[model samples]
Target: MPSPFPITLFAAPNTLCQTLTLTHERELSALKKAHSTELQTLVARIENTSLSTPNISTTSRTSRDLKRKREEKPDQDRAS
Candidate 1:
């Protein structure tokens, strides 16, 4: 199976200004449906994998350093 990344469709220079025939319209519709299904399946797999895994921590120690600085501000103001 191909990756679910976005795909671009290009029309020929001669066909660019021309109206699409019924066959071309059908083909375009089928391509769109296939792309949609692929995207849906990829998303489902990602969700299932995430659910099976443990939650990862995203917090940074920098926030703690910032909190410490804020706490020290009152002491500095008293010294002034």
Candidate 2:
């Protein structure tokens, strides 16, 4: 006579494994939501700072000057 109880016992570990996997997936989803919220808050803070400050053009002007210098310099190694 084959015992059916051994089959049930073998299946119990698979059930436990599925439950733990679901718990971990839920925890990861929660952490991802929290991080997204934090990133949004930081971005909003940066935007507010940029709007409030008046003298932030110095950095932009430097980059523009560098671009102009590159554009004015002719290609010296061109083979005509």
Estimate the TM-score of every prediction: 0.46, 0.56
Error of 2 at 43 (Å): 0.4
Q: Give, for candidate 2, the lowest lDDT window spanning 10 residues.
A: 71-80
lDDT of each: 0.82, 0.85
Please provide, for model 1 over 1-80, each residue's C-alpha lDDT reduced to its tens digit, 9 standing for 90 to 100: 88699766597755764546766888999999999999999999999999987655523556777899999999999999
Please list the Cα RMSD from the true structure of every candidate, rounded to 1 decimal place: 16.4, 10.4
**Candidate 1: segments with Cα more than 4 A from true spot:** 1-20, 58-80
Candidate 2 lDDT by residue in tens digits, 14-74: 8989988999999999999999999999999999998888665887898899988787665
Q: Point to the candidate with the largest TM-score.
A: 2
